[model samples]
Target: MAGLIDKAKNYVAEKVANMPMPVATVTDVDLKGVGIEGINYGAKVSVDNPYTHSIPICEISYTLKSADRVIATGTIPDPGSLVGKDKTILDVPVKVPHSVLVSLARDIGSDWDIDYELHIGLTIDLPVVGNFTIPLSTKGEIKLPTLSDLWSKNPPQSSV
Candidate 1:
């Protein structure tokens, strides 16, 4: 009886290990907006679901780091579901306070850009398999808006 149970467990494990799962990658990270609080950046994730049915996304947690310091970190719970048998694009937003930018002046001043690493945890509920987390990470440089670029957008109106 013990041998029979062990064989069953091994078979199940092998099936689960061979099952196709969702794959995700970070496409891009760019500046989204600027506000009094600071700057808003967004990370675009592309998830390719192999199953024929939609998967419920449990949560999306992210950490933004620069110069070995954490700039932003947060979790988005129950964001939504991934499209089945298709590619789904997800937007993850991160807000950095003005103080944090000020602290990283040394790195930013060099090339007028911020070098960052974004870490993401995408948790999805798979049928029969329970919850699974897909870890993703990407590193890149984001150019800061120049003074001229800002001025061009909101140009000062000459007093009439």
Candidate 2:
């Protein structure tokens, strides 16, 4: 009987050890706007208490898929910290004029899909056991508004 229980436990662990992780597309990187900025990333961790008493640190990587189907990838370690407990606002404190650059296909369109992935982790020393990434998604729209479109919303306008 004990052997059966142990086998079951081992099986469960194995299953969890190699489960499919959800992919997150970067919704936005708020840090790019301001110096010592806090990048606001949107990706909900499906599991409860992903950190579990461990400091959830993150490594951000930038990637781009051009309209021409060209794939470019670059990683930024310790780009910022995951701000908040459990899984909340993934705020990454970044340096001024961040080094990471994500250039889109200007030939196709001005819109670019910037991906800022948060890799929740305790410590790199712990190896795979400490590394954790919430299978959350990150993607959104950030279209540049025109001057008229931006100003027309406000009142107190008159032709002088």
Candidate 3:
């Protein structure tokens, strides 16, 4: 009985891990530089199920903020009806002309001592598994910035 249970757990974990996280492309960057306002953003999320089993209602939330304060928040529409071998691409758009000013700089000027990050992650529940009983683990975030730091790039000094 114990052996059967362990096998079942491993199988479950494998199935969960192998599932693909819906990926979206940040098509364009509408906002730039300090004190800049009215930013426009667009993203294309492509949903493709690599697993043999079907994924139902794959919904993801996207967040935008100047810093700690959230300016806009919305949820991506999951593919309606049964998603078979066909992959669906969702084009997402958000229009925010003004945002609450936080300490975070709006501009990425020449000094470029700024931090702009795009964090795209998935949070969903699998219908096949038990609610609360089954743990739908969340993945880590992948962060990207325009530059490392202010004085990091000095054109590589040579010591003769």
Candidate 4:
């Protein structure tokens, strides 16, 4: 009886290991907006769901690091659900306080951008699998907007 149970457990493990799961990737990160208290940056994530039914996303947690220091970390609870049998695109917004930006001035002043590593965890409830998290990370530089660029968007009218 014990031998039969061991064989069944092994079979189940093998099947779970061979199952097709969701795939996720961090595609891009860029500046989203500027605010008085902080600057908002957006990260784009692309996920492909293999299941035939929609899965509810538990949460999306993220951390942004620069110069080996974590500048921002937060959790987005119950963002949304992933599309069934299709691809879903998620946009995560991160806000870095002006105080934090001042601390990273060295890197930003050197190249007008900050070198960063963005770490993200996407948690989903999968059928029979319970809760699963897809860990995604990407390293890149985030460029700060220049005065000229900002002015161009809302160019001031010449005094009449």
Candidate 5:
């Protein structure tokens, strides 16, 4: 009886391993906005769904790191469902406090940008497969807003 159970478990594991799952990638990460409280960065993720029906996303978990230190981490629960047989785009927002940015002055002061690594987990529920997570990661530098960008020349004036 134990042998039979072991064989069955192997069969199930093999099937799960061969199953087709959704593909996801982190397309872009950019600085979105700045506020009095903090700076907002947005990560754009594109997921391709292979199923015929919409799949519910359990949650979107993200971790933002800079200078080998975690600056922000959070999860967005029940973000939405993915479109069937198509691609869906989702935005994950990370808010970095002014204090946190100030703490990384050494890295920022040298290049006028912050080097970052973003890790995103796209979790979804499948019919027979239970929960599946697609892990995505991206590394790049986010340029800090310059004083000139904020206080630059005025908009083009049209002659009346």
Candidate 6:
């Protein structure tokens, strides 16, 4: 009897281990907009669902780091759900305050860009398995908007 129960447990474990799971990746990160609070950047995430049913996304948490310092971090709760048996693209936004930019002046001054690493946690509710978290990370450089670029967008009015 003991041997039979042990074999059953082993079979269940093997089945779970071989189950198909969702896959995710960070496609790109770019400047989204500028506001009074500071600069807003968006990270594009692509997730592929293997199941034939839509999965509910519980939350998306992110951390933005520059020059080995954590510049920004936040979480988006109940973002939405992923498409069934298809790829879903999500835009995760991170805001860096003006003061934080000033603190990173040394790194930004060198090449007029910020070298960053973005870490994201995508949580999804899978059928029967409950919640599963897919960890993603990417590193790249983001160019800062120069004075000329800003001026070009909103030219200064000539004083009469």
| Candidate 6 worst ten-residue window by lDDT | 151-160
Mark the 10 consecutive residues where model 3 has the least summed lDDT.
132-141
Candidate lDDT (C-alpha), each: 0.87, 0.36, 0.43, 0.87, 0.86, 0.88
Error of 5 at 48 (Å): 0.7
Give a tens-digit lDDT track for model 1, residues 1-160: 9999999999999999999999999887877767789888888899999998899999999998999999999999999999989999999998989899999999999987788888999999998799999999988877777667565664222110
Q: Least accurate stretch of 10 residues (summed lDDT) in model 1?
A: 151-160
N/CA/C clash count, model 4:
0
TM-score, candidate 2, is 0.37
User: In candidate 5, what are the lDDT values of residues 17-125, reduced to their tens digit?
Assistant: 8878999988887777777988888888999999888999999999999999999999999999999999999999989898999999999999778888889999999
All candidates: TM-score: 0.92, 0.37, 0.46, 0.92, 0.87, 0.90
Q: On TM-score, who's better, 1 or 3? A: 1
Local distance difference test, candidate 4: 0.87
TM-score, candidate 6, is 0.90
Candidate 2's residue-wise lDDT over 18-108, tens digit each? 7543233333333123223322222222222333343444464433222333233444475434332343334333232213322333521
Alpha-carbon RMSD to native, per candidate = 6.0, 9.6, 10.6, 5.9, 6.2, 6.1
Model 5 Cα shift for residue 88 (angstroms): 0.6
Model 3, residue pairs in steric clash: 33-106, 33-107, 33-108, 34-106, 34-107
Model 1 alpha-carbon drift over 4 Å, by segment: 151-160
Model 1, residue 34: C-alpha shift (Å): 0.4
How does residue 77 of candidate 6 score in lDDT? 100
Error of 4 at 149 (Å): 3.1
Q: Backbone clashes per model, in order? A: 0, 3, 5, 0, 0, 0
Candidate 4 versus the native: TM-score? 0.92
